[model samples]
Target: MTEGNRMFIQDKRSYSRLLLMLLLLTALVSSSTRAVVHAAVKVPDTIRVAFFINLGTKYQSLTPVATLQSANGLNLIWRDPQTGISAGTIAPGQSVRFAMDGYRALLLETTDLGAAIAVLKKVQASSNAAFVTQLTKSGKTVYQVTEGAYSTAAQASSALTKWTNAGVAAGVQTLLSARVAGPWAVEAGSYASAAEAASAAAQLGNAGLDAFAALKPQNGTLSYVVRVGQEKDATALSALQQSVAAAGFANARIPDAVEPYTSLRTDMTLNGSANKPVTLYAIPSGPSTVLRAEPAGSGGILLTERNKRTYRGSMEMSVLNQSLAVVNEVDYEQYLYSVVGAEIGSKWPLEAQKAQAVAARSYALSSGMGFQIANVVDTTTSQAYYGIGYENANATEGVNQTAGEVMTQGGKAINAVFSANSGGITADNAIEIWGGDNSFLSSAVPSPDDGPQKGLLDWYYVALPSGQTGYIRSDLLENSGQTHVSGAKYLRVTGEGTAVRSKPQVVSTVEPVARVGTGTLVVQLGKVAEYSDYSWIEDPMTPDQLLTALNKRAKSPITGPLLTLEVTKRGPSGRVTEIAANGVPVNVGAGDNLRGALNSLKSTLFSVEETGRYTIVDGNGTVREVPSQSGSLQVIGGAGTSGSLPASNAFFMDGNGNLRAVTTSPLFVFSGKGYGHGLGMSQWGAKAFAEQGYDYQYILKYYYKNVSIEKGA
Candidate 1:
């Protein structure tokens, strides 16, 4: 028949007619006619059950098979942990059984009448044994193997025929493919034809294995594989395997070993004290991984479990430069206070502002050093408040005069690229830079003016083979170039030969900032900004400058609005312990004067308790009524100061930062800290901390209360 007519005739047939014919055929073949079988299989509600048989392997992530007795019909459960529950429909020739222990369950699904009859004949013993006796004894084909090398397929088919003739039922398949030899080569098993080996060899070229005639030198032709990349070591490979299994690739295997690279020492200081050593987790190629540490002396806590978040006291922060071991979280906070305090002033409320500043820095650093902290200081008192500091709760008034100007300029340049009504430059937008004479160079990036480039202003420039030069615009350009640069970015040499370093430097990264090339993602990490004339630039290879530039794009906020609550009275003396209504010795800022003290309380109080609310009195046979006025009383302790307060629990904080309230003698009821989880190190808090300078170690020490830092096994 013609191809078109064959297709039409085949398409015209209906499935209902086919089923009717099949039923009539079956009835004619049988001596007596019986109703069409509709075997109903019972499915269980909760399919999770312990097996009576022992599994040789300790763990099987997937349950592929189960066995049950057949009363009216067979009751079987096939649960694929990865795919959830599957019930009904056991078509002939398809496997419903998955792996149990050492055995397989004869799958109930099959459409083949012969195979079904064989399955019915099998005894109720081991599935494999029963299947062999029932199917093999019947002299029929029941399985298949196809789609590999022709030689292998032929061998399988012949074997199947022999088994079938010997009264052992089996199925076989035939496939077409050139026979080639390779187990290691990714393309070893694949082939167009034997004659195409040379072309394949030319294609492979120098990527390790070259195609050879006949899989020559079987021993030498072992597959060459890139087992693991430079990012992993032997220990890491094992962990990676575990992760892969947990991710559902249980059958996957890792290569035995890999070549080593020039390793760098990664020192970790989690929590404040360096006395305790931290275990190193596998490092990724990303910017950095955030870690957390609890209070000093607090017995070691491991944050290695997947998805478990914690605070970090110290970190082995990674940038372009070799990592540096740093000071405690508190010290970092102190350094920030000193810098900002010096920038603003060291006066009455300013001193108190420093404590709050420390708190803010600590909080941000705990999270992850990927956020921006807008510290709004009370310039008059030298005291800094968070959201409500300089202006209102929204910090609308907080503005960095220098940064604002740079932003305005950046906005104009970006508007030129994305078009006029494009709004301002965001970290998600791609930024392209041009060189001298309005020539475009480099691909776009997510954000402009990041970390190291924070202070430096960016502009378009035309790049040359040696370097680049260009003009920056304050207003929208009437005619901007739209031509794209081709090939790898090249710099042009103007006067003297410029020194070429692998990365940005403190000096030169700035001058060439406008000359970013095609592949330049963002300004180099960790270079200092230098300003000259009316232009700002960065050192490309300088680690400091790059870090500074990256920091600019960080919108993840480290410090939240200054938490504050009002208290009617001071703790014991003029010092504040808990709010007047509730007793939660939370972090309290300090100022030099009374107003400063009150301001500290206002900015730092996490939550407050209502003192005027009535307290329900429930006693056994005792009915007593208490006045509503004392409903919210926060108990005060004799010892109270800012600096010396206990890291955890209730502690009196005086103006000098002294920690008092060693024990909770008089219980005080209260609500405090945005989270009942406490201050210093929230896992969310840890990400916040890294945003500032508080590394993982600092976060750990801040939250975990006192213990001891020692080497962990």
Candidate 2:
């Protein structure tokens, strides 16, 4: 009885031990699985980009280094420091521990295999430390090239400085996703000739397979191989093989490691000769400290003033005219932070800011003309880019919300040109400014006044709050009545005179002048005058001054002195299409030239008038002569004056300030309307529209017809 009981107890103890072991194993397996899932979910798809920096001037040398006191350390490998080719990976720690004063990298990605391969080859040839990676996204292959990776975005910015130093085109972008290795491709066949391989590829492609001909070296011989489809794993490879067999390709196999086409050489170098500009790369000696450029060559390091300015990207100092030209090269989005505030007031509404951001982005990313070292200028010529000083919370928000968004037409970026106040109506692209049909930049219908009114003159009547009514010409108003309402308020005018009876009528005592004083709030009645740009402005120029300005701007030599100024033709916008000065036709073919010829007269819509006092001729010494007492003297050939000079045209002012008959040159006056080229989006108009509850998209659509706002590529 004792032996049987002992055997049963031993069996029970063994069973308990085995059960405990099984439970522990299950817990271990569950923990491992959870860790894998978490990692897969946590890994970011794209890198967090801080900003892009542009080196505005050519540099002689540059050096990048990690700050000694920074937690985040940089591992940089300069492929060609002079040419700005580098490769590095950052040890993540602080947000911006290492600061590269004048350098930034641009991560560019391409879906086009050929384009990607070309760029990779170019970078590899130019940069000794260049790296290229391939990633599969949404079942499509993408290739990416990074100039350098840094611990903090501030350090990574050195890439751009290097690129500019190498004189590379501003084609790099900062918005890029992390690259992952692509899958293996199934090779269908190999042939000695590319033409033969291409035929096979075509056949496979026709069978609904993604096929391409790639040249590869096999057994020391370059052979063109045809590939069908890419497979992520062995199971996918088997499935792809089966599909290829079914598509009539009996011999289809997946390579263990498909080598890239031989056309993309492993040792390919940059195509052109490297003309490395003089570059200087600065590194902060301590964390959160100002960066001082490491001196290179004979020139001592350009010491940047600490805390002088806070830049979003990096600062690039170059010698221009023997002085330092500090250029802040920041990322596209960061660049907009200051641009929006500088272009339009930061106090503008969010929608207006967003609209301005898009327009500025489009303009900056357009043709890349007028820029050598940087993408844009810090002025109206390109776009006002004042850097971090001008950046405001609202402007930054607008940039962030509309990040990577641009206005495009037919899948291409449009010009997105804009100006301050379109007066009333936007001008036609073909007729105004550039004299060509930019399909997207058509006339935008102005508020209150759609298109243009035929009968209304540019002049307007103003009723002042000081119990005075006066005739105010269109030019006197802040903006054209086109975008403004008839009863819009204007600045107060203390002293005023009589209001004209009607538009196109001369002001005289018969009209009854009403005296005005302080506290006068003038209000625009309506557009009662017709001229270019919705207003009439007079630009008075002496005969000599007119001739000099004209000759300076004329493409060809303007031989004669000022004689006759005539507007030969006018466009529908009332802008002078063709003009002649002194009978020698002024080349008004280009809008800019026309504007300059007219002393930069607000607009081309102008008429020239010559005026001088009339006098009578007499024998012996010239004496003062007045017309008959009943007859009034006439001032002929002046702006807005219409009359012929008398046959006795000799007239001069005597010593006693009396009129005498003597020859004298007449003063020329140019009367016109509006400001700017009168084309595209008007900044003031955009603000007005924004105030009226219009969104940025609506504002862009209104100005750019047949255009779509889409995320940037």
Candidate 3:
């Protein structure tokens, strides 16, 4: 009886096992088929990205990488190619792949295995190109064709053109390969400190040379060397040295091979002070972990000011400005995860977020500040970085999708600056701010209406009867025009009654105070200076108040009261470029400083109004008014002048410091529009463009004229 029961149970178990094996085989086949189909339709890989968990720290925990692969069901195998020995399985929460070094390869596409074999044969016959065979995730076989393995990107790029032109459709891809040991580099200079080396590198970059500061070990100590280029082979090295020499570096020479050093350090110090010992930690708190700092001696814990300050990298704290400053040294892309949200709203359109990510990445790469350690600040001075608390899902996604991407001009990172808004039009870097023509940074019309006006008669510069010179529309000129003034550099004001309004004549403010009186000339600095979204703000200051503000901000002393306020010079946007107070000429500062000087002034485009008369309206629908020439007047209304009238028209003091009226009346009005320095890609303008169905690339192209957006490393 026992033998029969055991045989029946064994047969049932065998049937179950066979069924499970068949199901597993079917799933495996289905997965392989799906991968092949996906590979066929997928775009060719352009980059091989090495995601770093901590940027500056010598030790990087591969936990994030493992976690990412596991979460995405990706099978990643790590082994030593030389020894052919298996290290171990890279499981979730383990840190293994720490090095952020890779090389770019060209992936050649083929219709089938036969086609790939044919290309490989042609490559071997035509040239000594190296080709690697591998199957893609989609189970499609492809060949990675390379001219030669190089130590530096410059050498790789120099060789890419030759292989691509060999009659093959190929795309560049990044591969995780060991760097060939090399010491040869085009040396620009060597410095005793990192700061000096960085300065030299910047100078070389300014001169259009690609240079970077590298730490080299010399005579038992480390020295910072400014390297213009690094090549593995002698031929490439010689070519670089010659090119740099031709580019004004007469002393550029190939230096002997030096051992490469990693920028990451072993341990990071936190709040190291003479009085207190250095505190070292491996990583910051995880996303779910609450942040708490322990006292130096006491075991007691103090909650961090920012409790949810999760960071992807390590941190170092130092005593800066007599206060503890913590710097988060994180991967370039992870840094942008926090930055994109802080700079622009996380809820912004995906395209807008992508644009911001690219701009932020370019900005960070071009930055030289803190290059010795973190490379950037955690505040608005660089880009407002609030760590993981400010990071959102969408923002992180944007950062991941645009990983390693940056804006480039002439094969180098461009200074991609952006602001909250451009006030409808962007400014040329040369004309508005730094005063040097950057072809990539030019004035761009963000609005369609900003284009030139049509059906308008020719404009001519003319001298008016009152001696004012400005451009006058042909229709506004009188018959006594004497055949429109010929070929003048500056536009001249013509006709007897023409005046310069704050905006174009149509839809302009009706207040006479808002318009520059007749006789003041106007020049065409740029396109028509009119913005429909122009804003207005009022800031009234008494003679004494104006004197106090001017004295506080002016580089030179501003004494006495303001006898007169006049805008002596204006920019192309009609923004005041120069102003005079009490006959003292003050050159308006560029960019944000223009508004910082006068805290109340929103923008340089403004008008000042002084009124000596006031109309007071009381509660009971009764009104009483004071004439401009009134000396001592008594209000006869429901409420006295003190409680009646708007705050804009408050009390005023006579020249003798006497309170002329006890009612709200006679106040100066300052009306203006816009905010911030109108330059580069405007945040609001980007949002508007995105809403109009324009992609981030189009928005960026519109603002940054003549710039290309390409996949970068």
- Top TM-score: which candidate number? 2
- Lowest lDDT block of 10, candidate 3: 264-273
lDDT of 1 by residue, 430-467 (tens): 11111122111112211111232235533322322223
Ranking by TM-score: 2, 3, 1
How close is each model in CA RMSD to the real structure? 39.3, 28.1, 29.4
- The TM-score values for the models, in the order shown, are 0.15, 0.43, 0.41
Which digits, one per residue and each the tens of the lDDT, describe model 3 over residues 1-713?
A: 69999999999999999999999999999655322111111111221111212333432212110111121121221111122211123233221111111222343533244444445555557543334332221233233333333435565565555555555433323232222322244776557776787666666655544455654444544566667642344667777777677767787767654333222111111111111211111111211111112122211111133343444443333222211234444566777888898888777788788888888877777664433334565655466777667889878887787776666677666678876656556655555554656677657464432112224444433333333222344455334323323222233334555653323334334532222334444433222322233444243456676666666667787766455555676666665666677557865445345565555465555666544444545457865554433344444444644333433323334444332222233334455655556667777777767768987777777777666565663
State, as a TM-score between 0 and 1, how close model 3 is to the true structure: 0.41
Q: Which candidate order results from sorting by lDDT in descending order? A: 2, 3, 1
Q: Of 2 and 3, which scores higher on lDDT?
A: 2
Model 3 misplacement above 4 A = 1-310, 319-325, 370-373, 447-546, 600-602, 611-668
- The parts of candidate 1 lying over 4 Å away from their true place are 1-225, 228-400, 404-573, 577-667, 671-713
lDDT of 1: 0.24
Judging by lDDT against the true structure, name the best candidate.
Answer: 2
Q: Give lDDT: candidate 2, residue 1.
A: 61
Off by over 4 Å in 2: 1-311, 317-327, 444-539, 605-609, 612-665
